[model samples]
Target: MKKTGITLCLLAMSVGLTSVVSAQTQLPNSDFEDIQSISGVADNGGQPYNYEYDSLGQGWISGNPVNRYLEIDHIFMKDTSFTHSGSHAIVMRTDSIGPVVAVGNAGLGEFVFNESNPFASIVFGAPFADRPHAFAGWYTYKSVGGVAPSDGDDRLINGDSLLILCYLTKWNSTLEKRDTVALASWTSSETVTDYTEFMIPFNYFSSDVPDSANVMFLSSSLGYVADFSERPFGVKGSTLVIDDIRMHYSGAGFDEYAELNGTAYTVGKKVVVRLEELPSDASVRIVDMAGRNLVSRQLSDKESTFELAYSGIAFVIVRSEKGTLTRKLYIH
Candidate 1:
């Protein structure tokens, strides 16, 4: 159905500003300076640097082997004396230390071991409530080969690529569990020599603000695909050094009327359309393909729920002095 005449004016809309968001929050131990044991130290030297660590302190979590791949586990994550800024920097590697090198390679995230799969679900995320414009960090990648099509850089693993994933999830009342509200991923080419600063931009999937989030940093992209049965095709000695990671947020200070998330809404269900203030002349109508009006109603209030008894295809029209907006919806 063609929208003939309409103007959807939202009068005096008001949107609340969360706050001034120029401040950037640095996550705990983001500098890779704090060192704690994810896996208890095998040997205690003395005090501060007494024991070796497979992981670090703070909320960071690392996946360490439980004796299956002990030889490869310790080398995967080493809190070495190497300093990007302070006493230590985190080093992750697909080292050639095990029977099958790079098989039990390491990555870090906020996760834990799963009961069904002892070594699975390795990294879990922490609660990150806000969305950042960019994720800024410093990292260096050193692998064997080039990141070219002809140069053994398959998406899976070859020269060994580094991956960092940041996810924002929320508990959905309908879904009954936490779900992903937004995500940002960073994949590095395997040919970086000096420590380079990186800025990863987020491509948000949903407009919904997130609840808890998870992050994953891996030295090799294909380390655990075979579940330690065999090594991945990535270079054995690939290494990633990282430090000084932080989240950057910027928000515009303003107020505006709430617009629909999209033009489409699922039919036969209560769909909430938000409005800060309703226009006095605002009107809504649903029409069939034959130009017959199915329902016509005056809209009021900051929130309105719409539902239709008719099934099949229809065009929902909202009109005010501003203009008309036609939305095609499939009713079931």
Candidate 2:
């Protein structure tokens, strides 16, 4: 009897391990391509929207550049940066309009938008007609040489010239300014040969602001600007370069799945489908192709697996804090 019991226990252990592996194959995971790029600029020279450009420095669909020499610069955002990722970033060319760069210049160093000049706010175009986009670049400025001049209200990372930094809100459609870590001064203790790095937060779009707003405006006060003067100063000719611009959702999407119980689970066999990986605090629901909700539960912990009976071609949908995921399981 002892020998028989030991054999059964070993068999059960093997079955459990196999069940885990199988179930993992059945659960769904998230992918990045599903999300769309809300706003950005590329290099191939196609219009993302309706707009006109002139050599005199004016994108006709929007407004005219005060300076004749300045035009919206072009670049190709790198794939490793923002383009293929999930969120947003906006850049500006800070040189076109100002007296030694003024702070009060309308839409000087930010994504400025309004009903009258919507085009002036977010101008859209493509560098290549075939490719999606090449770059989404902008410009800003910061005081250099520790000079807090009268017009220098805000200081940016690239001191003494155009500040080239990417703001997170411009990419994340769901986020606002208050939830981001504004760019502060770029500190480099080394010589000109030394490299300077900025520690940008992965989830800068999720940070809190002074108010609970969906559209938060970042200024020099919020790391977007540094201590140059009482107010943030705009440094002209300062260009913030962003290439391979992409957004990162961080929110999980549907991936894969597996079966945990029996190959032919009997009716009322207490069928439980274990998740291979859980993304966030998710809510689970078992449904049919016809969109009928058969089962629902919240996944607070890994122990929160799905329990159902054998049914034909059932789908398990997990809606978490990040996003929704779906997986198919068979029942007999």
Query: lDDT winner among the candidates?
Result: 1
Which lDDT values do the candidates have, in the order given? 0.50, 0.27
Steric clashes per prediction: 11, 57
Among these predicted structures, which one has the highest TM-score? Answer: 1
TM-score for each model: 0.55, 0.25
**Model 1: per-residue Cα lDDT over 1-332, one tens digit each:** 11011001001101111222223444567786666433333443563322233346665655432222234434223334444566666666665433333422322343433444333444454545676766667777776554433344464434556666555566677856555554445555557877788775443445666655556566665443313333344555567777778775655311112333324366365444444456688776665432235667787764666776666655566655544444556677
Which stretches of candidate 2 lie above 4 Å from their native place? 1-92, 96-146, 151-199, 204-232, 248-332
> lDDT value for candidate 2?
0.27
Scored against the true structure, residue 278 in model 2 reaches a CA lDDT of 62
